[model samples]
Target: MDEVVRRDVEHAHGDTRMISALAAPRRTSAGPAVLLLHDAFGLSDDMLRIAHDLARLGFPVLAADVWGDRTLPTTQEEIGPLIGSMVSNRSRWTARLDAALAAAADQPEVDPEQVVALGYCFGGSSALELLRTGGRLRGAVSIHGGLDLLEPDADWSAADPEAHVLVCTGADDPMATAEHRAALESGLRRAGVDWEIDLYSDTRHAFTSPHAKNSPTPDAVAYHPRSAARSWAATTRFLTELFPTVRPVEH
Candidate 1:
């Protein structure tokens, strides 16, 4: 079995301070490094469990907590407010993401060149920001995350086109309305970025969260076991293709 450990890493070059990262190390000599961004709920035990599972699949995963040590908001109202605030405050949050990626890539067991980023909800939405300047990331995967920014008219035409992107969003999410989805596809197409968007019907916001009864929006329901499992498999396949050193496990 692989080793799972928690790390508190500090960003050396930026204004962003220290953040918590849960690292799961594989048994092999080397593997790809992935920075996992948690949703608005912060770093829950479920996040760490996902990290461990990914590690077992041959990648060393780092699930970073961007909100320092803040507890999860108790209600949907508070959750909405927190998401609003975080999206408006991108510079600060992006810095933390940058730090997490830098730290994850620098680890001894990781292959920096093949680093990737994956996020859920706010974290997933934030992962798109990497595309703005995600040169270091070989690819990025966003699950049930909104692709829009705080500013409706913020231009992002200069993003790198070579980086791969996989986005899974709920079709019923008002936050990810039809217009928003069209805009994202348009932006990516205009930028010539290689990407794919998977829309799941009957799914809502935070579709990956195991506990989300009062999702306010109909799309904010409990996790879809099939969707979550399929997305994870697809992400793992993407990483394997990017970093060929990670061979599939033999049953």
Candidate 2:
């Protein structure tokens, strides 16, 4: 994995400037691209490790960063303020996501027409928001991400009808409440998107992250080996369906 600079993304609500993730594919690709978004912890080591896993599966992956060059948040207590501010100011993340996709498409290793976005934890929510904001993806996969509406009452008519969506959720996640799931379901259904969901039983938030237990509430963020394995399989399956040419190397 190497740090290749992605173009500066435009973001600002009350003076926040453009931020770069210093992120790129863990390895240069000879196939399609996946734009990977990080969680509230920012582009931490765990997130980069996950990006590497995806890269090994035969895709050039661009790790997306919303917070511009700021110190990475450690504990949930430290993360709360940064994530809270970004969520409350939805424009910040939406713009950041857009720029990440644009940057991914521009990379020489990427097939501009074959780009998809994948997110983990907070990134999962951003992936969905990219759809809500009309991001033109071949497909999207959200692994244990929040389901709340980023912009309640926002129009969905502009969303890309060609993009299919896969949502992998921990059924018991407090962060992904019933209300948020309902809103996501209704919005996606109303938008006429082709989508699927893997509701992992007894799972909680950040099921794919070993570092999830580092959060203040361990149980709420505990990792589930079963769900993690299954969700990753689901993600690869979804990607295959969208791009039959997507050749995933043996794990």
Candidate 3:
């Protein structure tokens, strides 16, 4: 695969503290855009790699940062509190996400009308939240992320008619339990949204992160290459179906 272009950018919400990364296929003209939301770990090399992968598939991508300048938590013990802090300030988090989506759509290389929001872990929930806001998005994809609905009675009446959703998860992931899945399904169904959830067997949380294997709690969160590849394949197909103008690169 060819190298994609990448650059750092700052997105100003009410606080102007978040920094984002933009990546896309080299030498390509304007194309569909993807607002890539990072996991609870915040922006990292793994997330950037995912952006590049999407760019190579003919979609411009922007990796949004939700954690501002806060240092990323390296250990499991620290991750809980860091995530809790963001969860406590859900309004601010949602604002930052909205800003990131706006910034991505405003990019010159992006076709704003054909934008999608794709996220992992905590970001997965953020993607769903974006949908709940009735943003002008073509679709949303959640990869092994939390499935809790922020608004049970959210009004999806203003959502884009073409809006689609895909949730990929590990069946054994304790964080994303059966209860969460059931609740998410009920909400989507009530909203009359088009959605699908693919559960991978024998996979745990963070299956898409190559560095998950190095985590202290490997049993709870480890990389599953097979699951990752399958989920990514599903994403590409979903994107292609949603935006027929952008064809995915054949591997």
Candidate 4:
């Protein structure tokens, strides 16, 4: 597989800021576009690997750095203060996601109408938040994200009724509790949204990452290889089904 160099994208609001993106153009040019959002730890090498893997599946994948040249917190001690301060402020976070999508859609190799958003960890949760604002995304996949079904202002009427959704999470992830999963499913059912949720038994957060390690205590983090592989396969199937034009290309 060929790798494309990272390009500078201007993220806008009142000020213009630049972010790096990795784009892999498809050989056929007829496939859909997939936007890969990295976890809160930021755009590490593993995220780039995932982008390449998705691109090899026949879609033009864009891996965006939502942090946008900013320093990301690495240790567990730093995560709480950083995310806790930013989580509730959806406006700032979703703007970053929106900018990434807008830039991806503008690419010559991308089909704007056939864009799919897939996120990992913090990104996974943000992908769903993007949906709340009524973006042009055709589908969304959340992988082991911290999800809550308590959107008081979610206008189910305005959402794309046919839009597909995939939630691939770990059964043992403390962040994604069974109650929350059930609530999400119930909310989707009530809204008549087309969605599927798969839980991997014994898998913790960030299972897909090879560097995944389990937390020793009840509130720590852990990863499961089996769960990660299975969830990835499920995500591939879901994306292919949603966008029939994109087919998996063996590497």
What TM-score fits each model? 0.84, 0.84, 0.89, 0.86
Clashes per prediction? Answer: 1, 0, 0, 2
Model 2 Cα shift for residue 97 (angstroms): 1.3
Q: What TM-score quantifies how close candidate 3 is to the native fold?
A: 0.89
Tens-place lDDT digits, model 3, residues 1-251 = 55577887787877657788899766557788899998878788888888988887888898987777634666668778867766677776677788888888877878888889999988898888787767778888999987653444555565564689999999988778888787777777767789999999999898988668786787778899999999999988888888788765444
For candidate 1, report its TM-score.
0.84
Which candidate's lDDT is highest?
3
Q: How displaced is residue 206 in candidate 3, in Å?
A: 0.9
lDDT of 4 by residue, 1-251 (tens): 44443454555533536364655644546458788888877767788788777767777877777766644557768666556645666676667778888888877778888888898988787777666566678888899877752353454554466677899988878778888787677666666679889988777777776546644553436767778888888988988787777665654
lDDT of each: 0.70, 0.74, 0.81, 0.72
Best by TM-score: 3
Off by over 4 Å in 2: 1-30, 149-154, 214-216, 248-251
User: Model 4: which residue pairs collide?
Assistant: 214-222, 215-221
lDDT tens digits, residues 137-176, model 1? 7778888776555244545565667778888887777667
- Which residue pairs in candidate 3 have backbone atoms (N, alpha carbon, C) closer than 3 angstroms, thus clashing? none
Please estimate how well model 3 matches the true structure, expressed as its whole-model Cα lDDT.
Answer: 0.81
Clashes of 3: 0
TM-score of 2: 0.84
**Candidates sorted on TM-score, descending:** 3, 4, 1, 2
